[model samples]
Target: MDSFTLNKAAGAVLMVLILTMGVGIVSDIIFEPTIPGEPGYEIVLATPEDSTSEVEPEPDVVPIGERLMAASASAGENVAKKCAACHSFDQGGGNKVGPALWNVMGRKPGGLDGFGYSSAMTAYGEEKPEWTYEGMDNFLAAPKQYISGTSMGFAGLRRPEERADMIAYLRELSENPMPLPGQ
Candidate 1:
């Protein structure tokens, strides 16, 4: 209200602030925090060798032919669903993002005329004339790895059983499915 009263109020606030600052400084000095040279817990990363020791050796993989012997086409159809986005499985099915995979089992890689085939795939076809059971298994296991520069973006089926099933399904897509290996 009055200049004197206002001055007193402002002085009180400034005193409070100063007291707070002083207390903080005193408390900090009294309770000085000690920082460790190293972190509280050291994070030890596993070296390649160390990691290998921890990882169990991969189980013995059954041969693709053996897996195919007991392969189920119905189960294979489900696995093939992943391929549907890129390829058409039906007979006379037109090419989608990838070529129509009808009769692809025995057919040569990159054989479809209308659909553009990557040069790598065409070269692969030149090297391997037809898609044999073992060849298909390897290719399906890792398309890019098998062909190197194949345009097929599918990551590939990891399980041998799934690959075998898929190969079985592809085999059935043909009018005369290639006889199962060793049969």
Candidate 2:
């Protein structure tokens, strides 16, 4: 391009930039007060325990493994219904959204072949090696928290009894249920 055209283009760009900055400055002055704590809006924070219709509070600090000893497999079956959408408990059950969970106890995380696993879960398997009732219990308590970036999106079984029951049911999925904690 000729120098004249180039200079015109540069001038036009500068004008647009100047106008953009001017608008930004004017908006800031209008939206934000010169003194602090005088913004266009005020933020209201909810006090602790102030929520209406309080939901179930988290259970006690008991170790999940100990809780597993009292876990009811029948109770777990009901919990398993939620899992049924993503996993099949029967032996040789094919992969669904999640891998077939048969014999998952003692199995490596993301162990199933051809079932795509998130990198976090695969890495977790490498770090943890094998699943014990304790590990599984923690994971079931909060799948995403235990293994961030994991493909499993389940929020987790919050109740200790519910988690134990689910674990008990999962134990039955295997031909050999691993020894319960403190057995």
> Residue pairs in steric clash, candidate 2?
none
State the lDDT of candidate 1 residue by residue for 1-183, as single tens digits: 999999999999999999999999999999999899987888887553543211121268787778888999889999999999989998899999999999998888888879999998888788878988888888888787677768889988888889888888888999998998787
For residue 153, model 1's alpha carbon misses the true position, in angstroms, by 1.0
**Best prediction by lDDT:** 1
Q: Model 2, residue 124: displacement in angstroms? A: 0.2
Query: What would the per-residue lDDT of candidate 2 be over residues 28-105, giving only the tens digit for each residue?
Result: 989985666765778886553553221233456577677777789999999999999999988999989999989998
Model 1 error, position 34 (Å)? 35
Lowest-lDDT window of 10 residues in candidate 2?
Answer: 48-57
Instruction: Give me the runs in candidate 1 sitting further than 4 Å from their true place.
Output: 1-59
Candidate 2 at 183: error in angstroms? 2.6
Question: RMSD in angstroms, all models?
Answer: 8.0, 12.3
